[model samples]
Target: MNATCEPRSPRAVRISSSPAELAGLGTLLKCVQAGVGDVPALLALAKDVGDTAPRPGAGRTALLWEILASVTAVDVAAGRILEPHLDAAAILAQAGGAAAADFASDRVSDRVPDSVPFEGAWGVFAAEAPGLTLEAGDAAGRTVLNGSKPWCSIAAQLDHAVLTARLAGGGRAAFAVNLHAAGVSFADPKWTSLGLREVPSGTVHFEAVPAIPLGGAGWYYQRPGFAWGGIGVAACWLGGAVAVARSYQGALQKAADGGREPDQLALAHLGEIDRTLAALIQYFARTAARIDAGELSGPGAWSEALRVRGGAAAAVERIQTLVSQNLGPGPLAFDPRYAKRMADLSLYIRQHHGMRDDAQLGALTFKGGHPW
Candidate 1:
């Protein structure tokens, strides 16, 4: 029963099909791969998917995550841009009430009035900063977002955003704001990172920028869809890990084809990567099913989301370590796709709150009816 003595997948074992294929997103995957490095094309693809992809908590939640995973596997940056956009759409769909009303005013004639069936690229900007703050206030008659929001990714390029802002009366609420409307501007900070270089997250400033409230005070985090959206981000992380693992798989295949047999350590790393990824994949499937079945519609979903996000972050780090320790710097220096994925994933996974999230999950366990 020695762990080190366990058999591993044969060197000839081909890279398995991803969930996207099984979920019938094969054609979409092909289109994404074809549009790989083009930001505009990728944004268009994201919009198309947001318009067409199934909403979370729907019966096809698994397929939705599969689509997200498939997009990330092809290109991490694209997936980075795509995820929040899709999540924004899904949030609006979940908020179906006065929040779903036509937010587009006289200034913006092109945007989708309904917003649930999104017509343009969207991003979520909810991250808080020390001094920077966005506030929802009434300017004479209409609701307007004033102040600034940090970590607004692709803010200049996105057509709209689902962002959180402090209310004048003292509470946080989610709003659908048109990025192109008057008084909306991006700080356009200097982004020096190589990973996700195309997707720069800068400060977005709103000066009486019109916004339509999506949900009631505290509803953004209070809703179950919030947890679902967080898990969807984890799906992207899982896909990025899959893309990195493929690099390792390709190296093994190349070595074998060139008559250089993989050593035991290499095989062991391969086994570890496969097993870890398999567990994460199954976790996603089960979580998706529960969401679709309405089993995780309450506070329980917070723990579930934290578990997947934490587990995925750890799995990604482990896979990255295994690949880097074994393959050395050749791929890092020479392989653009592989190198970009590594750097992008390293940044993307940081969205997980790390040990703070772990602590939250631990505290949740003390509460009765925890996910044990």
Candidate 2:
């Protein structure tokens, strides 16, 4: 149990009225503002919040999205790292068992830090690559993980991870494992990307690593919370897009301050971005409301999540284009923060799956009788 990875009680903080500040993010905003922006700090914040970030379909889903968006707006990389930790919490809660109970109880008590089951920083490593597969099987009457998992973002830094592994019966089962345990080793972080460089993601190999099975075979993806978690990622994308839009606005303001009047083309682009983002926000709110009302669950959740993610991803691309074309090469070439945001967002949104996801949504819509 590393002292730095221990979750602590959240402190009270003040908010500022700066024009750039996203005051509407509410309590979550204060948490982000008070913390030092780093992996350990983000993990501490995740554990401190514990089951507080309104689980999708449990109600207050809009507020949950706002919190995710606000974090990304402050820093896209932080948003990338935090969203999954929050999602992992939601999944554990939904999976309800001894581990989940222990996690819930440990958060409020003075128990030994990081010694409890399912405490500290956590990640969900479900991504699979070609020729790479993790398997779970019995060994000495206990289930253990073997093989490797890919795209495990900042895995070496986390204390625990909830991942999926193929069972002997030809299906996948979810399991939670301590990353610090023996037989858990990470590959050399060969990440060379400009975006999310702070979060080096790579492969982790397991040699009979002991684990706690989360749910029965196929339960991880079959649960409604899975779709809800996908929607949460879209929320992060929306937040990143908002930050880019703000950068463009800031550039425009600077130009005006220098006695240059706003041009029609730039204003038109801004108007278009505003319109697109406003509509996307409405869509997210509507989806969240439906999810809470039990209207978007089961099979329906899949398509609704796809729609939200697709729309959010498209909105991000459009915002990026508008900002880049108008601002030219100055921001990417000179402004470090701006450049980092651009690079981070460009890579982050790739998680959306683009047209492939669109195709899945199309199939789902046809199967659902075309609710248009």
Candidate 3:
């Protein structure tokens, strides 16, 4: 795999002083030592790290800043696969009340068992199909749900899922369902993509399955934490791109061993990749600092999160094009880890709603009040 190009000038890395930084550095060190090898293996490892609460009861953004630090240090699908449950748990904890107790049970970071996945993609597709629906059960604190939930990752592997369903009375609501419940079943994996085959996503059918509502209707996306989670996704993409840059390093080493000079054009492309990734990382740091300080709130949080996601997606796409060109076939064809990272990232970043998100951000931009 390619390595990140070494800087010509020697510079010492700064030591992290804040709790978020310390957590990130510690996680990053662990990942660097073990590193993220297999995509599925990382998720399994996360599941096995039982009872690990991320700074227990810490604010949503603070927890995300720390966890996501390691995510980028590793790779894409590894982070994306594990993020939802952690994000859900933290968000639930911050929301407090019965919702907190529900997720805080064995389902979340409590014992980590295969962890859990938040399945809400259907909410985005509600206009086109029949999404899952929820009905109040005869028993108090219980409800029955039926219909299909799509874009479910690691469907059979996860023991529980947090899904959004249409309430019988009409508005949308989030429900936490135990996958092993009687009426729940996982369909054959329908994902055929080259990237992220490890975390296959498909339709999950629920038939009168019992569920616990998470917050009230519209409570799911109407919080600052939603945008915080988006920033976490961007962090994953940044990590994947970093892995790709590492592959380029291997290419440089190969050339040196062959007594060949580094190609100017390749170096130029590498320069761009380095600059782009550096800027993204710095941006995350600034935002994370704001998050930790409780400064990232109000109407601006989501828009700011949108900008970070858009910028990271754009950087990753640029890196993909540049890396493929500069290194040619060797890395893509021969380097297994690099190849997997690139492929996984390619699919993982699609989680960012392409032109639609860009358009939304543009509209926000045109309104002209957003800070530069």
Candidate 4:
């Protein structure tokens, strides 16, 4: 062994907020709005978070999530429940790993309601490939992916996708493929029962076509950013909750001024939703801090993150129930926007991995094996 490898004390790494990060995020959001999906812009955004290094702490995932969140915030500000846009933001945040936890919290306050959509998949296909039999291959030195990906939010609008596929060697890989590439196609854009109708989500098909590799094969799951994707999904749900509460409050104010009795149930529901958002923000903040400090390493840290995500999913379900009940048949009248908002929230929150049976099983396995 090299003498230089003698046991060394771990150096303390401080987790400080970066104004530059915030500014960069703002600039990137503007570019996204301007249709600047050029490679130069993407690379520049990557560099802002130190994405080119051997191990770029949070990597591209964190950047993607922040970008998504900012765009969703823009939509929320415009009073439109753009659930697909919000889902995109969540997916990007979870791409890199737990490193996005801080990025998510710090930037949530700055989000604006912009109508731009992200051009990448939310990593659902890639993350689920190992167990789902999703497949990819190379044809004539150009990467090709073939599979059916359900619930690709913004599929119709996106120009490209960072798609994931399995290798012949029983491993996984990812590639960036243009949606307009030869042999690539999408199913008819049908509106779901839920409120977010603009997403244009549908199935996508791929025959052998050209694709640019993302990270190395098998690197998608093993990367830290993949786990953090849940946090992004959680943040989007929380944002939806915020939108619902705002709508309820506005309705309550109108009823009060009109000499109508306040909807006591709606008020109570708003309180519960508020409480959940507060707790989630605090939990995510602490988790981010711990991960930054390197204290949240190993299986235990991942388990805790999963628990947070599951809890967020449950809170969202409760909020949706309460909102629908309080709004009553008024939302269904087609005049009030409450119904649409509720529909958007319902569809968006259901996108999380925790909503699946296997996700629950995975969480149980981690918790049972280690209490840390």
Candidate 5:
């Protein structure tokens, strides 16, 4: 995929604490909180000639951009090339929420060297199977693959996919599979889930489909970037938790009517949930800053990312309890908003990478001798 790498604007440059920076991050968070529908429209307008890139301006949108820009700046500070590919994928994922499949479809042709490996894991997990093996043979004048990848995330819509296959050397290699090629098919075409329903998390079957190699065998877990991406996934979980917490606040205001006695038990539960979320957010922010400062490296960075993931997962569970207790039993049946919030929260919480055995191991490695 073609991308232009221009010098980053002043705003893109990493800076120490500043009011302008804080304001920017707040705007980005607010934008994420407001909703995802406005993003395409914003991007479209921002693309016009002679028009400056859209700023968050006065509203929550500005705050959301600031937060995102701050994060991006951190990446820049860490000596990472701030590629549009990474930023675009992150933006699309956030903007589309569970329904990001539509956006993924349009960007299918823009596959990069890294997309295959990243989405390959998603496919394998969706399959919920023991493993996936990628194979290559001559087909349609090119190398082709034969295997199945379930829960390909944007696989149903994307033009190409990065697939993993077992090598003769007893390791795995990621191959890029073209979705539109002959012998490539999607199974269970009409499936949908509660959150990220638009992601088209279905099964993909490759019958000797053409494929391209992504690096060498055993590159998946060997690369530090993969671990870094795991941290980003945790950030997304934190975002979902933020959404749930905000939704709970709105629900609480609506529940308070005519000076009704606030349920003491429910309030206590909500308070605890708030504290948990706050702690997780702080940890995430701190980890991100450390990553920016170059203090976290090697396994230490991965361990910290896992810690954030576990913290986020626990926070989500607590938030769910708060939502259920505060909203009461009747809200689920009567309030579609509450139902949607719960559904979204539940689906987002299932991101399994954070809770994997490796993450647990990382936690143990980091928290040696620490008392709970």
Candidate 6:
């Protein structure tokens, strides 16, 4: 209500994704500088007081902020906000245990250490992908890690990170690593121009590095909270999608009211885009509510998480394409918000893993009770 859709997102949610109207916290947008397309301004938003840390059940609102922030900050800021939520979820899953969760629980709660950047490095790029090789051997009573982890975001700037590695015997174990520890070094940044350049993600090399072992081998991925965290990433994607599509909102509205001139050919595309956005927004709202209610569990949870993620990724691709086609070169060339958002969302959703991931959902579906 404060302004018409800003050719960005969040400012005009009332006109798009109803029932999820973005209100207040408009300050999060200033975190980006369109002309520069960098994240220093966005990163500055994290300098809030200790009380600014997210509390329990703040995931949905946090996700909305992630979306809103992406409209301007180009997802670097949103991603910074998102990783901590995931860290909290992981720790919250292992609350009673004193294993690796203890380290995470100690740092992720109400009084989390302020301004410490954390990244989650779980993706592997090697086709052979033996995974981050780790031996169970002891080094003077300290756990020794040797190998590399791909997608370690901003390891240079990050003080700590959560990682998953393959043990000598082949089972996967999770660890909280100190980037400043001895023998920990980062490969030159491999991520170039896929849109999230500000994130600085690449492979991190560890030679006899020290790490704090967290939960058991399977706890990192098997826990219910893992699925919830997956949904949070989808929320970020949807946020970026909304921001990208706002470029065509006026066209969409005029088309809906009978296009007068100039863009009559875009009418059908605009209408379809509107419907597509409505459905995606509804699904996003439902999933976020389920997460907040702790209703996503049982064997069906991962199935449902995949449903949200896959659907959001597809919707984002569709919206980005339609918006670009309908609006032509004006926005993508002159409007930094639209250009950056399109690039960011398009790249970020690549986390979906394509058919390889869909195959996991297929396996779940064949087992029945698939919560679609």
Reference-based TM-score of each model:
0.90, 0.88, 0.80, 0.64, 0.64, 0.76
TM-score of 6: 0.76
> Global lDDT of each model?
0.81, 0.79, 0.63, 0.49, 0.47, 0.57
Error of 5 at 178 (Å): 3.0
Mark the 10 consecutive residues where model 2 has the least summed lDDT: 1-10
TM-score of model number 1: 0.90
Q: How displaced is residue 48 in candidate 1, in Å?
A: 0.9
Clashes of 2: 0
RMSD of 6: 6.1
Candidate 4 residues 157-186, lDDT tens each?
555455577777787776545566567677
Indicate whether candidate 1 or candidate 5 has the larger lDDT. Answer: 1
lDDT (10s digit) by residue, model 1, range 231-348 = 9999999888887787787788777777877899999999999999998988888888889899999989999999999999999999999988888887777767778888999999
Model 3 superposed RMSD (Cα):
5.9
- In terms of lDDT, model 1 sits at 0.81
Candidate 1's C-alpha runs over 4 A off are 1-23, 104-118
lDDT of 2 by residue, 1-372 (tens): 000011132221111123233354456655665653467777777776555667767877877777778778767887888888888888887887665665445552333222336578889999999999999988867678899999999999898888999999999989877798778899987999989888888999998877778789999999989999999999999888887887787778777767876689989999999998889988888888888889877677888888889999999999999888888887788777778878999999999898899899888877763558
Rank by TM-score (best first): 1, 2, 3, 6, 4, 5
> What digit string (tens of lDDT, one per residue) describes model 5 on residues 139-158?
44544567776656545544
Largest TM-score belongs to which candidate? 1
Q: Tens digit of lDDT per residue, candidate 6, span 1-372?
A: 011135343352432233443444344444333423344433344333112533323455444434433443334335544444344434533533454344445453332222123433222121114454444335666566787777666566655655677676667766666677677788897677757666767777878876666666776678766676677567667667666666566545544456445355566776777788788777766766665677765566788889888987888888778767667777667766556667766777887998888899999889885754
Report residue 343 deviation for candidate 4 (angstroms).
Answer: 0.8
